[model samples]
Target: MTPKRVVIAGAGQGGFQVAASLRQDGFDGEVLLVGDEPGLPYQRPPLSKEYIKTGNADRLLFRNADFFEKNAIRYLDGRRLAAIHRADATVELDDGQVHGFDHLVLALGARNRRLPIAGMELEGVMQLRTLADAERIRTAIAPGLSLVVIGGGFIGLEIAATAAAAGAKVTVLEATDRLMSRVVSPAISAHFLAMHRASGVDIRLGTMARGIRDNGRGRAAAVEIEGGAVDADLVLVSAGIVPNVEIAEAAGLYVQDGIRVNDLMETSAAEISAIGDCASFPFGHDGTLIRLESVQNAIDQAKCVVQRLLGRPEPYDKVPWFWSDQAAFKLQIAGLTAGADHQVARPSDDGAKLTVHCFRHGALIGVETVNAPGDHMMARKLLALATPPTLETVEAAGYDLKAVFAAVSA
Candidate 1:
């Protein structure tokens, strides 16, 4: 029997993982990983944080070059997938090459949303998304340099923290009332706002960027807000990203917020599926269509897709988890809390450790922890368990929520 051919587009985190997981699941087929980036697959979470400050490119690599050869995964770097010929079961590359596949996975991920204000075309303004973006930001980070970050989202705040720690005057401007308002809870946002303020980051909330001013030599001189202007040598636009689903949509696939996929990650079209930031799947608890851009989501969903390809049908119902490292704090979260009604806080003895439990109609829906890994781990287990603890039980267990969970489990 001839081995099956699996062609994956967008060789980022999820794209690369899909190929690896397919082989791991005993699918001895031709795996072709295509990415527009010109190198091996690498982790993107550090691109805005550590990679921007340390310039440690080696540490960002997901796997070595030899691993691809050993696994028989053909990686085509610096090549963009212009179109998907779904009818013919082939992918059209920019170089006019058509690769046929028995199965196709669209892990096209997302692209950073660009600022529309004036002077954005200036040289000093940048966006952090790919390795090249990190390289540019890394070289621009110098002591005494004024760095103005637009957007108070995770990427912007993480970059702001790194820039501040590197001795740069970092100022974060967010149009929203709080940072990370879309994904995290109000308590978590307040905690991070306090943390950033304490770390000397000038955070300006409810502020919108009017335009950018150029010093006439094609470099950004300052960022203009509604009331006044702040002088900045470098401007980093860390706005959120939009899913890359144009090609998939052009190929007559369902596109709603992202490429719509079923529990098995299969799209509307046969022999074609989507995953990662570009794919919106059914979230278990609320049964709502959700798209997650975290590394954990990408990897776990890739595993599910691989299992399905190997004829092992299983629902992709893994608990969602995410983390963000800034300065000395590691903020970890387990499970989704999209429509939670109430939140409970549990602070540690030292006041540095904090955990916030999100409840939807008295049931534990999500958990947010800062510098508290044990509690975060327990929260994941509790979310996956048959009977989650009630709010009353959580309150009776004292501030040490992990101990309460442990005692109950024992």
Candidate 2:
């Protein structure tokens, strides 16, 4: 039974992929993409990096107007889903438009998590999530301005580096001792810590940013720390994000950290599938489910779900990969690095390249490469192998991933 009408909520990258993939895969169905934001779907990663400096909003667009018209996609921008009627297979938008759907795909992305700290209401404090937010920061940033970033994650560090390069006095306050502790190995964290500090950016580790201090004019004056306040003309909160799953939960779907979905990306109820950041899909590891916020997950899961709807039911199992560009360094990672008990760091002779291999129970779990594109590409190929080389094989190869990969391929 081919679905006639397919409604996808949240026109972010995932939702856009689902709609585009459906048409590209020869599905002659009605595709409706409803987005809360007004405009074409754009790339978010550059909002903090390239957009902060260049302000080229036009380059961020995934597709222009003609693609939608040619593909016959009914795009409803500036619309939010109010409720989902699972029984009737229809969704009501905030504008009171009830659209019937043979299949509903929830590509709802995540929103920035606002921490409960004082002085967050200040005028100069902001969070980078949308194009409008980036515009505000680009207009506000200037040479000799004091910028304080509250988180030391990839986004915060990348923003810090960009600001510093623009002649802004950048300061990063990380609550944890190691930078990117939750994702990367300590070796990779240490490398970035040194790289950032060498670029004249002040980085404070294990330092909690308690609150923002307000200026007399209702603006941010400084960021209050354990010792004292640091003067801040602008403040950026990169405290991570929370998945948007309220609509799914309201419709009585199972919700954990995110909207829970099966291997086929189907939700608790049939004819409804969930993908992207809002979906916690089964990982085929120890029967546990993990939600990824990377672009790879969004694109791959969308394709997987569309295939299922087209009667080709293949499970969504793809290698996870992520990348971050800070200053001159590009860090790329493959596979899940969580719960890794051991790490082996390999640095080039000139100190220009490095890769950190993470192992769990003597098996390779993940690989993090800094400024090494070749290693990063090989790491992804290696991880996709059914039986990746063990820690011993890697050690025997003198921690040379290229040689290890070549031998395995041989």
Candidate 3:
């Protein structure tokens, strides 16, 4: 049966895409997007980059008030999903309001993993997840102020670079041996490590932050790490994120690392589906269930769900792509880097571009490019092909990726 009404939970990137895709897919069903945050849905990537510098909240919105009205998508902002009555096909809000739906979409995004150390509740200690969090950090940032960032992931590095550019004495503490150890290749990590360090940011690897030390006035004064304490007026914890799956878990959904969903983005329950960062679905060559926190993943999964809802069911198999801006370099990645066995680095003619080709058993698995949009675009195009360019082809072309693609086609 076609659903007459659809209720979407959470209004992050995925949640916003669900409503827009439904309209684009010719679904006339009444759409209800419920979010815990107030105001229109906004893009989160800029919260750590441009938004920090400009403080322009208006530019972050995905759609303004009129877009919702024009599309007939009802938005319930600043409300929490209290309970999900699976049998009754209804969702109750924290305000005691219950809404019935023939179909339900859970776009519940992840929350920042909290630092368990002491003095964490003190003022000036913050986490970046929402626009409000970015505003707090912006208000706290000042020239010559000590800013300590925990974790060297994309968010942490971006914040460190931005703060350093703004004249804050920034220090980053990462528990991992190298920056972005769990994601990017070692070559890429080394590049960024040097980039950040050269930009005057102190990056400490394999350093664990034991606790945050509070100043006499109840504000964070320093972060205690291994061997010594790094004095700071502000501390930003970008350690990681925990998926928001309390409501899904309570409703008896198959919850693994995240809400488990099949390729069609359907949950174990017939009417309920999950997408975006909070949902784990099978992908990759090994078909392992993994949840990705990229905007591309969220948007692609939402489109797949919309297709299924429109009676054209297809597996979600979009190739993952991601990018980050730190200091003067723009790092772009195509395909998954997990389980890659070897990598080849190619420096461009002028020395401005560098592309790292990752391979697993001689097959091109992923590509990481620095300040090279053409290479990144070509990599994405090649990854989408039925028979992608191989490592031999790349090496034969003398690392000129465009030549490799041309040779393969010719």
- Per-residue lDDT of candidate 3, residues 273-294 (tens digit): 9999999999866789899999
lDDT of each: 0.89, 0.92, 0.92
- Residue 321 error, candidate 1, Å: 0.7
Q: Relative to the unseen true structure, what is the C-alpha lDDT of residue 123 in candidate 2, on a scale of 0 to 100?
A: 95
The residue-by-residue lDDT of candidate 1 on 253-285, one tens digit each, is: 999999999999999986888999999999875
Model 1 compared with the native: what TM-score?
A: 0.96
Cα displacement (angstroms), candidate 2, residue 144, comes to: 0.7
Model 2 / residue 69 / CA error / Å: 0.4
lDDT of 2 by residue, 5-97 (tens): 999998988999999999999999899999999899887989888999999999999999999999999999999999999888899999999
Off-target runs (Cα >4 Å) in candidate 3 are: none
Clashes of each: 0, 0, 0
Could you tell me the lDDT of residue 153 within candidate 2?
Answer: 96
